[model samples]
Target: MKRQIIDTIEQYETIIIHRHVRPDPDAYGSQMGLKALLEKNYPKKRIMAAGTHDVLLSYLAEPDCVAEEDYNGALVIVTDTANTDRIDGPYFDRGAFLLKIDHHPNEDPYGDERWVNTDASSCSEMIYTLFEEGQASSGWEMSAEAARFLFAGIVGDTGRFMFQSATEKTFEVASSLIKQNFDRTQLFADMYEVDRKILHLQGYIYQNFTIDENGAAYIKLTQEILKQFNVTVAETSDLVGSLGNVKGICAWIIFVEEDDQIRVRLRSKGPVINTLAMQYKGGGHPLASGASVYSWKEADEVIGKLQELCRNY
Candidate 1:
């Protein structure tokens, strides 16, 4: 699969890159990293990064992201997208060919040339492998920009190498990127820095943590609380992942109230929370999953199922 894409890259004159929406560090990292690499090696090719510039503001300043109109007869590289529906940017359809580089567990082919290695820790790692060992002719050297972006993606997806997915290979990639003189300390500080207000909200959320008999922690954020904090569902979705690390906690769930539904974030250590989430019609990786329930009462029902699963696990 990688060789096929490398062949396409060699043949294509124009290359455009994209990723999932909302621009997490991993998505942005893979998008920016690949863009810089392609442009460095194939300088003659026209390459553009596509998607939300506002969301990419933290990682990128003056953006090369372009619109669909700018992308006729170009090769589109979609990275870090788990599913086809989540791939944003209209330029994808405008491309002459589609290529995908993703590391998510589920691989649905979105492009003519798809390189989906669920075994890889991050999409950045896949790109790193390509440049190092794949059949890409030039094996483009990583620029400072490329190194930083790729490092960010690896750090983001692996939770700064804290998640189970982080492995020896992950660190090897990080080490290689660091050799390009990336500011490791500054990047780490920037990546982990949360707003004081969000920190306070997290404190408040933690103060209200509810633990069941089986040591599963849970927190529910009401609409009024969310409004008071000026936080959206996006801000709170990843919060549960932090709670799963508590010493006494075997699993955790955060339920945030939105308009008419409750968004549930589920996480576990020894148990497979994805199955638990699936019981409520939600799905994700084994350690993490999410779902939405209609009402608070429904949320209680979902919690009951989770508790049962916890007891059994």
Candidate 2:
């Protein structure tokens, strides 16, 4: 599969990379890292990374403004996205060839070629493996910038090597990337640095989150509450993880109000919560998932389901 993907890339003079909408570090990292890797090896090829901007990861790379014509004869490679509906743009099918590279569950496979590895810690790790295999066979090199971006994705998705999905293979892949001579300490500093306002937001979550009898911790953030904190919806992405470590809390959820609907971010310490997320309008990994609900009643029902799961566990 790796060789096939490489061969497909070699056949195309234009390659466009994409990821899910409202991308996280893993999405941005894999997309940017693959683009950098391809550009370094195939300098003559026009490789561009396209997606919506993630405010938190904007410092890494900006999404290229790709024209429709760019996909006329291009190979479209989507990374870190599982479903077609989650794709950031409409140009996926416009490409001459489609390739899907992801570490998520294969819920929706919409590509001519796919390399989906759910066991991998992150899509960035998969990209690293692909590059290493491709490099060995084709004598291509992995650049330091590419290594850094890939490393960021691994760390981000693995929660700084704290998540259970991060295994020995994850460490081995990370070691290879770190040996490329990127500043590891600086990268950690950059990833963790936060301003005072964000710190206050954390305090708010800690203070205001409610705990159910079944040890499910939850917080509902309406637009007014978000306005009070003066934070955008994107900034709340990391807040759900903060509730994970609370004492006696087996499950945690954050319900953030969007324009027309409510977005729910669910996390669990050991229980399988993605099933419950799928019952709602979302699906993801077992321990971590996301869902969308139309009203507070729907959100409450989802929460009730999570609470039941916790009680059974």
Candidate 3:
């Protein structure tokens, strides 16, 4: 599979990288890292990273605006995305070949070639392994920037090595990147740094968070509450994790009101929440997932289902 991916890359003079919309660090990192890795090895090839911007992860490279003509004869490689509908760009199928590389469950697998591995901790980890193996077999170069980007992805998705997905192989890949002498301390600082407004919002989340008798904790952030705290929707991304450490809380969710609908981020200590997310028009890892709802009633139903999951546990 690694050889096939490399051969596909070599066959194309132009490559366009895509990921899921509403970019997270893992999405940005894997996409940017792959772009860097390909450019470092195939310096002459034209490679572009395409996606929506994420202000929370702006430290990474900005997404490129690739024209439709660029995809005419290009190879499209999508990273960290599980489904076709979530891909940010419209030119994904316009490429000569579509390659899917992800660490999510193979639900909507629609690619010419796929390297899906659910066992891998993050897509960044998979990318690191690909480059590590490719370097030994085909003499590919792994740049420091690429390493940093991959590290960010691994750390972001793994919750800084706290998530259950972080296995021994995860550490092995991380150690390989650490050997490149990237600044781990600086990366952690950049990822964790928060302004006063965000700090105040965190306080609000802590103060207003509610836990049901079933041990399902949750916080709802409406647009008015966002304005009250002077925080953007993007600023609330990291706050979901704050509810995870509370005792007796088996499942947790954060509901943020979006322009069109309600966005949900789901996390569980020991229960399958992805399946539940699927019922609500979303899916992700078993322990961590996401969903969106059309109204407050739908959001309440999701919360009710999550509460039942906690009770069953």
Report clash pairs, candidate 3: none
Better of 1 and 2 by TM-score: 2
The ten-residue window of minimal lDDT in model 1 covers 54-63
lDDT scores of the candidates, listed in order: 0.78, 0.89, 0.90
Quote each prediction's TM-score.
Answer: 0.65, 0.70, 0.70
Estimate, for each residue in 1-313, the C-alpha lDDT of model 1 and write its tens digit. 5666777888878888888876677888888888888878778888788776542236343347586667777888899997778886766778888887888866576677778888788998888888785424555677887888888889888887889998898898888889997787777776656344468688887788888878777888999898888767667654666675566787888899988778888888768888777767789999888888888998888778778777887
Q: Per-residue alpha-carbon lDDT of model 2 for 1-313, expressed as tens digits? A: 8998898999999999999997877998899999999999999999998877867675577889988989998999999999999988778889999999999999898899899999999999999999988889998898889998999999999999999999999999998899897787877776776344567888999999999888988899999988998877888886779887789999989999989999999999989999988988899999999999999999899888888889999
The TM-score obtained by model 1 is 0.65
Question: How does residue 299 of candidate 3 score in lDDT?
Answer: 90
The reply for model 3, stretches above 4 Å from the true place, is 194-202, 205-230, 236-313
- By TM-score, how accurate is candidate 2? 0.70
On residues 1-313, what C-alpha lDDT tens digit does candidate 3 reach at each position? 8887888888999999999998777998899999999989999999999877777677677999999899998899999999999999888999999999999999988899999999999999999988977898899988998999999999999998999999999998888898776888988887876445678887888888899888898899999999998677887887888887787888899999989999999999998999999998999999999999999999999988998998898
Q: Model 3 TM-score?
A: 0.70
